[model samples]
Target: MLKDDQFWISDDKAKLDMSVIKGYLARSYWAGQRLEEIIERSVQNSLCYGIYRAEGQVGFARVVTDDATIYYLCDVFIDEEFRGMGLGKKLVQYITQSERFRNIPGMLGTRDAHELYEQFEFRRDGDILMRRRPDHMRS
Candidate 1:
């Protein structure tokens, strides 16, 4: 768990607000075509991270990993009202630098957040994809 006052990110799916997640994704360019059933199944099959405050869920991200060689970080978003607060970086940092994933190489797709993820060593792979090297652990 990563904390910032009352706002924190947890890897507990039960703590997630499916509505907020789905609503956000439903309007996202990358995930807009995804259906509720698809989102639900993805959460069930991946490790979900939900960011919350006293209000409710405000951000989300999920990781598809094998715990041994690779991982895929996807569906990342921070609520509009929560933007400009650095929560996205905090969330990505928490996931990438945590004990379980610290040394693991991973991948993510972002339409325009390259500079943000690049701070964590995620370099370009393709048009919308970025690859984090295996050495992308916190120093």
Candidate 2:
């Protein structure tokens, strides 16, 4: 059972068989790959992760790190059906306030989520924002 404030979250994929994860991602425009593969990839890259509910992966957030410090937050997603209920805020708070994340200076890029992250001290600096998506993956 997963709660908004719980650290340990378990989804059906860890126990029973279910396709909801894949279905959710497919509907969300995540390109290719099956549910199990996606789940495996997410698990592999996260320093720590949680899967909410038994049917769907309502949210996911990961830390890109060099182990000791310097962590980059990436891949934050909250299922469309589950948005607007403060779940995203809770997830961000959990990630940034945790002891594991406190010492590390966390960084993330967001299109419209600045308000939520602002509560966690994430500010939209007007100095410099840069990206370099390679040609092969150019948009």
Candidate 3:
């Protein structure tokens, strides 16, 4: 858990405002076309963090980890209305500093926000990130 005057972040998935998460990701380049069931299933399976203000959830991040070795960070976002207030930095800082993940190697894919992630020591590995989508995902 992390908190300040106006925002708080937690690892409790039950506390997540799924509507807020779904709404944001529904329009995101990476997840915009994802189905609600897929979103819910992903959140259920991953270690999730939700950032909130007085009103409601405003940011989110999820990590897929084995509790040792590797950690894949994904779905990171701070609401457009909530950006520029350092909340994104705070969210990443909290995750990177967490004892559970600090020593583990991490990976992520982003077409933007490289600078934001670089601040936390995340760098591009030589190999490109790739995926093999399921048959249902074939165009």
Query: 1-139, model 3: which lDDT tens digit per residue?
Result: 8988889999998889999999999989999999999999999999999999889899999999897767888999999998999999999889886877777777788887777877777766534342222222233
Worst 10 residues of 1 by lDDT: 130-139
- Scored by Cα lDDT, where does model 2 land? 0.56
Best by lDDT: 1
TM-score of each: 0.95, 0.63, 0.89
lDDT per residue (tens digit) for residues 1-139 in model 1 = 8778878999988899999999999999999999899999999999999999999999999999999999999999999999998889989999988889878988999998999899888999988999987764545
Flag the better candidate by TM-score, 1 or 2.
1
Cα lDDT for residue 36, model 1? 98
Which model is ahead, 1 or 3, in terms of lDDT? 1
lDDT of 2 by residue, 19-98 (tens): 44444545553334446676657646565444566454567666677745467765566678778867777677676666
Cα displacement (Å) at residue 35, model 2 = 13
Whole-model lDDT values for every prediction? 0.91, 0.56, 0.84
- Pairs with steric clashes in candidate 3: none
Rank by TM-score (best first): 1, 3, 2
